[model samples]
Target: MTTLFDRFERAFMPNYGVPPVALARGEGTRVWDVDGAEYLDFIGGIAVTSLGHAHPALVEAVSTQVATLAHTSNLFLHEPEVKLAERLLALLEQPGKVFLANSGTEANEAALKLAIKYGKTTGRSYFVAAEMGFHGRTLGSLSLTGKPSIRDQFGPFATDVRFVPYGDADALAKAVDENCAAVFLEPTQGEAGVVPPPDGYFAAAREIATRTGALLVADEIQSAIGRTGHWFAHQADGVVPDLLTLAKGLGGGLPIGAVVGFGAAGTIFAKGDHGSTFGGNPISCAAALAVLDNVDLEHVRAVAERLRTGLEGIAHPLLNGVRGRGLWLAAVLTEDRAAQVQTAAQQAGFLVNAVQPDAIRLAPPLVVTPAEIDTFLAAFPAILTEAHHG
Candidate 1:
């Protein structure tokens, strides 16, 4: 008998290839497919579900806000929107402006626009972005992204966008100049398989952007909201960016994106500059506020250490190393068999990601228990051995 997969192929767009499983329901860090096959959720909806699936707090917040007022457009004021913005600013510990959008790409596009508009006043016409850094898919943000395969066909991107090697302060310094409008980067290259920059790299980029009179925009989409045991990853580097773009884990599974501008960069937009119809939807903002309330740095730090020790403790060949901050980690495999490992793990009631050929990315829910980590660790060595030699 043809399953829902057949119907999915017949009805849905082929943009994402074909999803392997049809997840029916979830609770905490575990999910069950339509066939009732249970699996531990380490993907965390690609790191969007910060508190985990169907978290009680997130559910209550979303349900309450949705019933009260789902949306009022940007033309009207709402309590949830204002409150969420205020909360983010307070967490930032800095006075700035926040623009809410529906996704990380939109947030990035807004930041890019602000940078461009600011550049118009300063006589700068170019931008610098880190190579291998994943920004977003929108045309504007896509131009800022450094992946050639994603950009090569999407030609003539926002012109004068230059690429610099990530973590190389010298290359970044050389790329930024008086003519540069902004330097776009990530606190850590999360999509580049949990790659973190060297010590003081952000400081160097900050100094360069400041010296060159260019806005420094840090895309904290995958690294913020307690992912690194901090509100934002840049805080670890002690670098305050002129502009910050965030999403993924922001809204606790609800779609919400934000562009935070500091000091002068905050008010770069005048009236009628940029707007979003469903940006800052009350339901999404409420979900984000709940996540903010539940964010526990101490708990997240402990989880990170547990995962680090768990993965490192395994004395297996393929499972060679681990890298990342807090719960957003990558188990570096000895060979380019990450895809195979992910499949094998999934079949064994575990879920992981092959972010790259050699990197198995893991962004589990902040609510994941120590027992869950132990369970995955117990199966991980044999799983790697199977992928390696079996």
Candidate 2:
């Protein structure tokens, strides 16, 4: 019999493959499948649902804004967009400008252009980015991504970018030169199994960028908007980036991205330099503001700490260690059976990501509770056991 999965495979592009389960509903930090089975949603739509599923504040803001003014594009001005920019600047505590977009890739594209234009003024053409960092999937942003497997076929990419090893201060210093336009980094490497860089690495990068006169761009697409218990992940280290890109949890599951630039990078873009039709739509702006105002970040940060402790307390044999900060973390396995572990986790009524062969990344909503963490911790030992045995 031809099933729903078969139909999806036939009709859709196979980039993500056919997901095993189709969720019908979600509330708080939980979701239900078409068969009515419930799951503790630990993935949170790849860290997009910061306020959890179907958050009332987000729902109301989106609903009201859609009912009022939906989209004005970049040809017109809107209050919600202005308000969001102001709010973000308030959080950043810097003189800056915000360019809103539809997703993380779009934000990165805009940032790339801003850097290139700023470079034109400075007489620089080269760019430096960290290896193992994920910017996005669109061709422009994809070119900046350091993964060879994904970046291989999409060749003829602009040769302006040079890659350095993540968290390696000496390598970054060597790579970033006077001719470099910008240096891109991720506060925490999310797709590379939620890896955390060494302490003071960002500070070192900031100093290097300053020395080279290059714009320091921080891709906080996966770690911004309180995902790491700070408004921006770089804030934890007290470093202000020249260009900060954000998406993921910014709109609390609604699609929206932003490129926030500071100092000279802030004023580099003039009219018509970049624009997106659906970017900064009133509804998305409203939803983002609601997420910023209503999320219980204090509780979220506390639960994140507890999760770090609770996961390590399991002390499973196949488990090597856990890395990352706040709600974004990866349980590093001793073997390359992370795919099996992910499947086992799904079978066991949990949702986690095998971001790498030996790493399982966990990026639950910021609204996740202590009880929810307990549930995942309870199931993890057995899940690891199944993967190790299989």
Expressed as tens digits, the lDDT of each residue in 90-202 for candidate 1 is 99999999999999999999999999998899899999998888999889988988888787788897557999899999998888889999999999897788999899999
The whole-model lDDT of each prediction reads 0.91, 0.91
> What's the TM for model 1?
0.98
Clashing pairs for model 1 are none
For model 2, how does the per-residue alpha-carbon lDDT over 248-317 read when each residue is reduced to its tens digit?
A: 8998989999999998788899877888999998999999999999767688789999899988898888
10 residues in a row with least lDDT, candidate 2: 152-161
Off by over 4 Å in 2: none
Give TM-scores for every candidate, taking all chains together and pairing residue i with residue i.
Answer: 0.98, 0.98
